[model samples]
Target: MDTGPETGTGTSEQTTSQSARPGYKQLLRTADAWTFLLPGFAARQPFAMLTIGIVLLVQHTTGSYGSAGVVSAATGVSMALFAPQSGKLADRFGQGAVLLPGVLVHTAAIAALISLALAHAPLWALLAAAVPAGASVPQVGPMVRSRWAVKLNGSPLMSTAAAFESVTDEFTFVVGPVLATALCTSVHPAAGLVAEAALTLVGGLLFAAQRRTAPVPSRLAGGGTRHASALTVPGVRVLAIVFLGIGSVFGGMQVSLTAFTQAIGEPGINGLLYGTFAAGNMCAGVVCGAIAWKVTPQRRLLVAYPLLTLACSTLWAVHAVPLLGALGLLVGLCIAPSLITGYTLVESLVPAAARTEAFTWLTGAVALGQAAAATVSGQLADRFGASAGFLVPLGGTALALATLLTLRRRLSTTRQDG
Candidate 1:
């Protein structure tokens, strides 16, 4: 029942002990934390690879960006629909019980998709394979965050942990795409997906094996009543919507960048450019986590959302490849701080019983946004060219900003014991 201080109140209660704010060296010394973190981090590598991998693989085989978009979107749609159910199962059972089976099914599905794509199977077959591939994606990120919540509960280190996870996510996105692109372009279009399947199996097993840190199933205090769904939680609903917008920005950027590079005769460089975008987020996330903020998480989000909107809007005008890369880096600056704060707020809002499910809802929103953005952006790129597709992210950013403004008051109610 110990939540940290309410953010953005500008009071001494919001501050933490000096010792709680450990340096990077001291942070790593928490060996048990890393044991839980590393495997999940490895598992996440495939998340970044899958969407782009499908795009590249299908596009190469069918020679149509729209087909590639639909195939990739199918995965997102499946993940979006099924992620919450998986998380709820993890919460009811345990990480290992859910993840082991999930990983097996997910890996097998990805393999099937790869085989189908390599053989130039019908588009419907490829799309059908994507369903189980995505639906069975182990909820690694949410599970890890939930573990952090349990491990760091009632401590100031919660913010630091959130920042670390956010940075880890950015880092994975940075490397995953580059690695996938290299494997696809140099080896074969299916190489990236094959590698993703391998990583999922290895990392999922390693992460699930750490039973000591896994969260115990929730039980009511005085009775055996079940907890309400995370969907019914007020703040969770708001944040999920916001996350949807953020996901759209990311999805649109990825698909548009691919089309742009392909148009400019540098399809191979798409990963590098995407890495540049994530590089900015990684660097900022490191700094954001290290520093103690005086403002509430809501205040930080208010500022960060507008900045993201402005940054994404600028992409609409970017024509030159080098300038676009630079703009991508600039646009990435606010992403980490926003996400770090958003997750922290989500932590404050939901009770421990529904923590994993709540976090998974956030991830589901992102997947939903990605599903919509990939299809829409790809269509725009095909019809109006790549730069024109930037409008999708721009529109998403604007809508996110509006959502925040509308819900600002509700989000500001972040108390330590909510």
Candidate 2:
């Protein structure tokens, strides 16, 4: 039996062979490709910025990185818990119906959180504001992937679409953090959150307006009956765990970089260092998409994940800024392959009806891991130092690697289900 994604096409081997070759130019020219892509990119930029912005503002207000991490973690935790539900609603209803109200709520919630932070309200008040802000985050990334799946369901270009989306995500990370950090440090502590809110409102509206390209609601696609959650699939669970490890790397890096820069008495360089790491991810994504590969996504994922762990292991030992930046770039380079592969595997693992929900579960797991890492790393950095904070990524990825090794067989998708 063929082990590749069942793209609904009978010629799995032929399609898989074609997928290994470059065809991004063809993907770009697909009908209505840019109609949603531009707005979707704009809408998701806040996803990368929100947590870091919260961290900066709260730290500035409270004079405690630990406090900052706790607040941001609350936001991330809420997002993790609620994002999948949002996706489920989108699958049943429509993306526009779900996104419009979500963006509105998110903007108001973020504004409230910023105001309370500036007012020096109690942490409980801030946490209350954070939960809604996070819970209301628009599920743009997963929604966009769902659209791509609709557009190129069984086409060989679907693999390229995954790579392209990964590249787009990395690019947003590259821009979002640098923009947030610059705004926060150079302008005002709350400037980043303000910008994030504005972008979410405007971009979310624009993306929601593009109803022409939106996937048909599963309720409409199928019968009116309810669909099961994506987590029912064992592969989704495994992938979600893998993404959590990746999220820990992101969270640990954010806090540890802040501490490292502040320790050197040049806190402004934190953005540049993080940007360098993000640039590595974007570069790798570009290359990953362009190459033709005969190896399956599962095998590619297994290879890439161990490399990510090995790269992260050295993060705790680096003290010099340049050395740390170099190490960060290396770590970033190892990340895209695993991310791209995991996403590619999802096409074969989950049914089309629950695709959006499956994507959100993986995305939410990242947010959840990032939240946990940010909290622990922040506390460690405050009491111990930045070096201690850096250990979180290594520890998270190592544990995940062990899990992957133990449950490697579960990662395979022998059949696709809806």
Candidate 3:
């Protein structure tokens, strides 16, 4: 059966000799593609919805933004701390092995959280539970990307897959937070919590079930100690810095949205404002996918980084109500394409056995950066001005853009992406 993902037009018999060579359509049309990807899409809906629910639930329950922030930070920190090891594990024992542990841990964490809330446990205990819970982050999207890239014989299907993932990710973030916000405010917040638990269980399980899409373990690790090496590699380092800027812009934007909405006493407006940002990103990513760039991956970054920089920098001027949304939309427009490009490039540059670890490193970097950004942005908004807080991200985005330009010459393409 043909998978839902479409292929280009079929070739004439004259092209029959070329059948030995596979294209993206054929690869994506395979059983492995639909089995992995469709489930992945189904899984994303709740994945995003649950995460946003957790944040909102905890924040509302504790009535302390600091505690909420720490819990949120813990999730990122745990992911950052464990992703490399988890990724390496995926490389060693196949992606499915690590996924089981990750999801169980994640499910337990959410369940533990609900249980603690019912038991009225202290904040410290809550934090303790969260630490273990965060560690269970299933390496879903990255593993799928790597799996598909190999499935497609390393054709440009990788780019298409990345674009497809980006679009879904953007959609998930957009709808997830809004739905979570609504659920948290409704007559029952616990229902949202329960829903989150179910998702982590089902989504995590379905993803792990598709053995065909799991990475084939290598005899030896392609690269040693990705957590250490990702920082050392020039290209990884450059991309890491870009992720830092992305984290700051996104993290600060999140906090700012909440603050602004709460300030106006229409607290739910945060979802609306943030949704616009996601819409911009989705549109931007689709546009990028449509534009076929002959430029090298590194060169693509050269062009994209500046656009991303300008997008974030533009937020500094967002004092006007309409302009605030416009600036956010502009930033969103540039954000996903740049991120998708950078990540796709990273996938190509890193070795196959190390691909999982490499992606984890990238996710961790962005998460860590966002964690730091959230803490700092909260303080800045409290002390100086809410409007002025955007300057920090503006400056950071500029710095990231500069770093990418400086290292553009040394950037390496992932042989797999070739």
Candidate 4:
């Protein structure tokens, strides 16, 4: 298998190609790569909206941030728990087979949750509706990464693909939250979720229809034997844990920023503030992808992870909106390299057949961590104020960094393809 500079295990051919430092234009020109990328981007945008949309709508109805956070946490927890199973099914069958029904169910579920929230139903009823809403979230991001893995396998361009996809994901975050926040604040409290459902329906169907680009099912590809879960891999586990911490930054920021804006009688600024943070991530992704790095992905991750912790440590101390926006941007800037490096590392760490599942495990880890953090941060914000909620990202990253440090050696043992 061809490896890039990331693994430092590439053959001379890989080294020769790596010497030129492939760009995004080269990556996009690869055999209709843009076909799936566009629809996949639309399909995945709803994910960025789900938690924040839930929080916004529920908070508006319940008049309690804690309740809002709990409802959103329910959705996140269900998604994190069920997403891997969805990926496993996609791997065994095909992405289209899994995604078609997943999207339909997700749209219906989101509708139900929105109705339940609008009706001021009991928390139990809302939680019940949220379960399927999240559980059925189409695994578009993971599926897209799997598509790229198939398209660019054994090429130096795989790292470029990884970086590009991370940028796409970050870009969606930039657009999704701002759009959701705008729809909710300007239109109606439930407008964000309404748009989320509509997009999931339209975008999900469009993405699923592009079946030609889908990766081959593992069983059809002659890997019919029962494969263990990707989480069984120690390296995957470590990466998942690290991703969970990264998710905390997202969750904490969403709730804390909202509370901060609300506390200052400027509730509409939530989207702009969050957008600035996500913009930082997108900018860094562009820069990270454009660079021709000599360092291994593992080393890059080590350096980037610490910087994320350091950047997040200061978020709790700032009350000024301008400073908060600037600091949030800095925190955002620190995130993309870690995310890009982690995805790049997946190339050498897992076999081709289980690639989608591996991606989902990391994705699900982010959801789970975000869910837990949203719950904790919401409670903290409700009691102690928005500043207290910011602490979640700092503490979460610190713990994750420590774990990555101790288990750092496991990441070096890449899978040896024969």
Best by lDDT: 2
> Worst ten-residue run, lDDT, model 4?
1-10
Residues 81-193, candidate 1: write the lDDT tens digits. 99999888887777788999999999999999999998999999999999999899888999999987776664566677788888998998899989999999999999999
Candidate 4, after superposition: displacement of residue 107 in Å? 0.7
Q: How big is the RMSD of model 3? A: 5.2
Report the C-alpha lDDT of model 4 over 72-115, residue by residue, as the tens digit.
Answer: 99999999999999988998898999988988899889889988
Candidate 2 lDDT, tens digit per residue, 1-418? 2111233433543454346445788778666779999999999999989988999999999989899999999999999999999999998898999999999999999999999999999999999999999999999999999888776766667778889999999898899999999999999999999999999999999999998778788777777866678898888889999999999999999998998898989989888999899889988988888776789888999999999999999899889889999999999999999899888888888887888899999899999999999999999999998889999999999988888888889887764563
List the lowest-lDDT window of 10 residues for candidate 3.
1-10
- The residue pairs in collision within model 2 are none
- Report the C-alpha lDDT of model 3 over 80-144, residue by residue, as the tens digit: 67776787677667777887777777888878887775576777877787677667767676677
Clashing residue pairs in candidate 3 (N, C-alpha, C atoms within 3 angstroms) = 348-414, 349-414
Estimate the TM-score for candidate 3. 0.85
Residue 333 alpha-carbon offset, candidate 4, angstroms: 0.3
> In model 3, what is the error at residue 124, expressed in angstroms?
3.1
lDDT of each: 0.83, 0.89, 0.66, 0.88
Instruction: Name the regions of candidate 1 deviating beyond 4 angstroms.
Output: 1-19, 22-26, 219-223, 412-418
